[model samples]
Target chain A: MKLSEDEIRRITLTAINEMGDDATPELVKKAVSRAVSKLDTQPDFSKSTSSNQGRLILTSFGLNQTGVVAKITTELSECGCDLQDISQKLMDDFYTLIVIVDISGSSKNMSEIQEKMNKIAEALKIKIYLQHEEIFRQMHRI
Target chain B: MPFEFEEILETIKMTEIEHFDIRTVTMGISLRDCVDRNIEVTKQKMYDKILKYGSNHVKYAQEVEKRYGISIANKRISITPLSIPLDAFKWEDFVEVAKTLDKAAAEIGIDYLAGYSALVQKGFTNGELELLKSIPYTLSETKRICSSVNVASTKAGINIDAINLVAEAIKKTAEMTKDQDSIGCAKFVCFANAVEDNPFVAGAFHGISEPEVVLNVGISGPGVVLDAIKAAGSCDMNHLADVIKRTVFKITRAGELLGRKVAEQHGIPFGIVDVSLAPTPAEGDSIGDILMAMGLADIGGPGTTAALALLNDSVKKAGLMASTNVGGMSGAFIPVSEDQGMIRAVENGSLCIEKLEAMTCVCSVGLDMIAVPGDTTAATIAGVIADEAAIGIINDKTTAVRIIPAYGKKVGDSVDYGGLLGKAPIMSVRNINCSTFMGRGGRFPAPTRSLTN
Candidate 1:
């Protein structure tokens, strides 16, 4: 828990007034700790969901193969992942697919999803990379 | 698509093909409070403190890597300089501390743990002198421990006496570990104006003023920059610099994000991102390749220093724009052994010690990972270090010497330490005796540049 400057100043002033010229370093420390303990509210992180922690950017490429999207989407759906957007391109026999997924509602974590995707990639003879969308936002955006 | 198709592909290509990766995510843990009067107690306190803060360092970093899909090459730790805290102990006790640190680092699952260092740029304390005496043994006995000593700085001038001591320590470390191509010397560095929060190992130390613990990152992507410069095809110098800045800006952003994410996982304050273009032994990851791509015929050519200056400046400009906390040696690194192109240049007689020294005037480090004949005298090595320190003091930039006086190996012979230490071809050095000058060593007074304050 971190106290703001104003809160710390208030606490220090209050402690000094209460000590009334009798405060030593030890007593001041004790008073500050007691005052701080009075406001012991845990920092709530779960309520702040503004970050891109739950979003993932999935990129895949390989030789053009049928049912690749169906196979991938089925796996994601089974894992409770929501596919928000996708863009793909095909030239000659090679195809590349980029996907945006919101994994906040998914039961599995990033590692588990990556493990399942690795098996799918090996079976389909393609390469699939699932990375947090924050990385893209960091590099491509400001 | 919120992100352009080309941007997506560019990021992917940088990672999958161009060998883009975070070089190191070093956790700086201050061991200031762990010192005790008893050697055994001090050792125990140090071990427990390191484990308390560093047990999950590698695991958290791996989790971030999995989430971001960006590879982190090395997860390391740097602590308060050993000689500072253990200044009251004897040289033998310092060796015990080194072993304890090595053990703790191994248990923490890190490959390297730095901060076995001393800062004697002005003069040495009794304990600092003792620590220097213990370095050869500490380096020889410990596997994961890395040591460094600062013998010169801009404000305090050059400590030629300390340099001679460090030179002797280097020679002894080389001879002690001679069975492995004098590999122990690779783990030691002699610095002038060493930075406190540098995340790169063999040179990093948690400065005295740093917080209790912080995470610092070193970003590396020579291949990405090289490819970008090549793609700018036939452009003039200004256009080339613009191209390099844009590329570096994006990488620096990504590097900072990765660093902050890892720091968040560890619940530690995030430190600066070292925007140095450190090279690895792998092909296409060479800083020399980037220099050549900037139109240098080779690494040690005539215009090489100017090209490096441009690259280093652009790197700093982009890094400063990309992240608010850009520190460390944020420039281009030109270590010979770790860079494949530099190795090729040295092998072909293109890059030499003198040229590398001149290039260091513009870059971050000086004479890094250079190999010389086994018969090179301690005074000659001191001459080399003194020269490098003179450049660093005069310019007020961080410079270091990680030269390996490869034991029993002469010029035309190469020392192969494998892995990231890479392979260094022994370059010939002039045999002019500088001992009388070194023997008269008191202190090289501060340069005129030190009077800015």
Candidate 2:
């Protein structure tokens, strides 16, 4: 969590923007010092808490159509799954969607969620795959 | 935060478009404790041990697949070579043991069960000879049993007598299963320096040195490597090697992670990860395709062996870096019938048995899945095995021969064994007679290199 000189400058500029006309050199310096100290004391919360929740990735592939995301997310929400991230792209009339969800909060088990997802995929005429997040991490990271 | 969208997309693309997968998750179960003086009792003990240790193997592998969105193509089991425990029994008893293995494999829902094997690198024991004699009948009678015989090693030289016997047994197996394109030969392999922890089939068997039960994973991705090379566009040899090494590192890491998870789930030790570029008959998944991507006009051409050496070395280096324990035949596999690109090369006359032999000198395995004419002599088959064994012994690397004598078939005829075994066109062998050389049945002494002590 070390802040570079560039990052400190950016923080100082942001503090100035917040202070407006009241921004003086001494006041800005004080704000910058406080900010640096606060960052030093706080551990990287995102990194530390990343594995606290169960993570799942859902991918779908099929013909391009409307409301595919809406239909899928609605089903996910109904299962008490929280959508954490999503990316979708369409090329040559073919649609591909990759959705990451935090399933720790989900009321349903993995198999039950899979069964529901499979039915939705069948109804939509798309091939949907659900896998845990660790797979992607293991494959992509060293 | 460093995991980019592009990387995720690449993994997905490899799986969806390139047929990337964990080829096999094999559970190696040692059956040394199942020995008994009574043949039937020994057979019963083997069945019970395999059932007890491997009943949940397939289910656990499936769970890992579902969790990771990765496909595990096969769940298999390998036991200690059967000869050790059944040595006191008759040849008929070995067949009964093969039947028991096949029954347990079917009952436990595994595709193949390996370990119907004998080790006679130097010389054969009575029990080893009995097991070797039972190979044809056992393989023809059973559906899921695979067998291997280690006939040579660097430390013990070549067992010429054992090679001759195995060659004859292979011919007999083909004759017995000629109705099905001699499919039984596909289940047998003769090794020069066989390893105990190989997770790939037709040769995989739990060695006596291994623990009671362990999980070994074989990862295959010729498609992924090809994609990475294509993405690199054009580069120097060093840069190309770097690209392959980096790509293989990622692939092996993924396999190691999955293997550890599966082993943990099964409460067993995680054995080695075999990072071989094992190809299927699927289009775009061929090792030959990888060579073609490397600017080769055709496989088995002038530069094929050099390209293979580079690919194999890069794979091993990257795999070693990615995992603490990397063993088995961790190199590029060039099985003729199993790889579609190789099949095309053979059919087009660009590749031949001679060039394939030369390639095996540098690649992982030896003359594998090759189909010869029905009229091939057992002496000629022995010559082939001896040649491959000499290369392995001199180089001190594991080599195997899994050739099929296609019965009632000659050159210009192709036999289709379907699925992973694929189709192999009958390739002509050298016409020079080696009966005089093979007639002198004796041990080929260990090489000068064996005097390291």
Candidate 3:
């Protein structure tokens, strides 16, 4: 079952009210998606798995500007990389972008993708780092 | 599963803002099979084996760095003590072997190659004696080869004779490299109870009991721990310990992950993850800074030892919980010259040699990277070594002395070595002579604590 934008927003608001001041935006989204995906109806998207198939993380930091997301997403899609989740914030006058990507369908290996991303990062005047998803899980989950 | 956004941000900040990094990935290869009665054959075999095993080491490490986005600062190699395999060789032959090791290290693009060393804790064979005699020349002649001499252990007692020999050799090394601020001594260490799998240079060597090949990882992040403590503002002692422990746990886990990956790539066994907070000369990356953050006015002031004791214990506890194989001096390292806060303390007269000795009793290694006056006598250096050895013996811990006697430089004159070895300010030593004590030359018996049998 695919939930409408309004339904997702209502579920997030309900989660926020239940969780009080401690309910972060990420937490609210996670809770609502988890509950909705647990129902008998099939969700529109596949759930995350522990497989090593094209899983990666990309982080970028630089001056805030317009069209940053559009340019990055366009380049990512061209490389056959799918953006799983993305979070962006402007703090202390600089923009920070954290993205989780699935690259199993990509035409390039990790190093090749890194080389392409390096060119884009340089063109955009930002510093970009690409890492495997296992680093995050090994460091944070256990 | 999706990673927590805060956790990913924290990891990035630790590497970018803070100076957290993998200090070294040292491959220890046993050279026992290279032994030959013919010195030339021995040297040839040694060089061939190192080149064969170490050819792709730097490339593989770089590939891993790019894949994981973690920086590995140094790629180094350690071999079985040269004295063991080259027992029949003379001092000149040993120098040739040192040159071979140095050339191989340079060819492989590694920064340092250790194990130009001798283990004379109980007594010295003729080869060990010759190796000790060749150390000053070996260190002065080569650029990448490091030397270490283990003169004492808990079960073997202090080898005063070997300590005296090393003291004289250190003086000679300083005199030979006087043009470069006596920098040759920086690559030398005298240890009590040295471990085989230590990944840090100037002290690492493949032990006889180890396998043919192993990979040991040394992870360092004094800056990360300092940031964690600052984040937990005004917490009590127990809470402070918890903060440090949790932070170190994360650091060690990251190191373990990298170690396993690197070892698997190289087709070698993962030895251990050394969770030592080895500091560099950068700002905010000092062990002394961590102590100051923990409420010490100065690194050598009152309560300094207690603070260091707490920090060291907490690091070990967390590392044990995080890693399956935690070994090789796994605690906080307080190398004076390498830590900017430590250098500042010495310059301001708040820290002194004696206080550093006291602090070493509770820390990872003892009296590291210190520089004393150039005119300091060999007997006096031996006195310093003897004191550190006694501490290690009684406590059954690893202690080492890597002091530099900056030739023709007096107290307050600093010697700058520039990179990770950093700078050293010549500090005052005791004026009293200990020649008679050093001249006694007899071994100090094993301490009562070694009677665990």
Candidate with best DockQ: 1
lDDT of 2 by residue, B328-375 (tens): 899999988989899999999899989999999899999999999999
- The C-alpha stretches of model 2 lying farther than 4 A from their native spots are A1-53, A61-64, A88-96, B450-453
Q: Which pairs clash (backbone N, Cα, C closer than 3 Å) in model 2?
A: none
* Position B209, candidate 3: lDDT: 90
True contacts kept of each: 0.62, 0.51, 0.62
The chain A TM-scores for the candidates, taken one by one, are 0.65, 0.61, 0.60
Query: Alpha carbon lDDT of residue A109, candidate 1?
Result: 78
Candidate order by lDDT, decreasing, is 1, 3, 2
lDDT of 1 by residue, A68-104 (tens): 9888889998989999998999999999999988888
- Scored by lDDT, model 2 comes in at 0.88
Per-residue lDDT tens digits for candidate 3, residues A1-142, read: 6554446776767787778888778887788777676554744212213223658999888988888878888888898998999998789879888898898988767787788888988898988888998888888877
Deviation of model 3 at A136, angstroms: 1.0
Best by TM-score: 1
TM-score pick, better of 1 and 2: 1
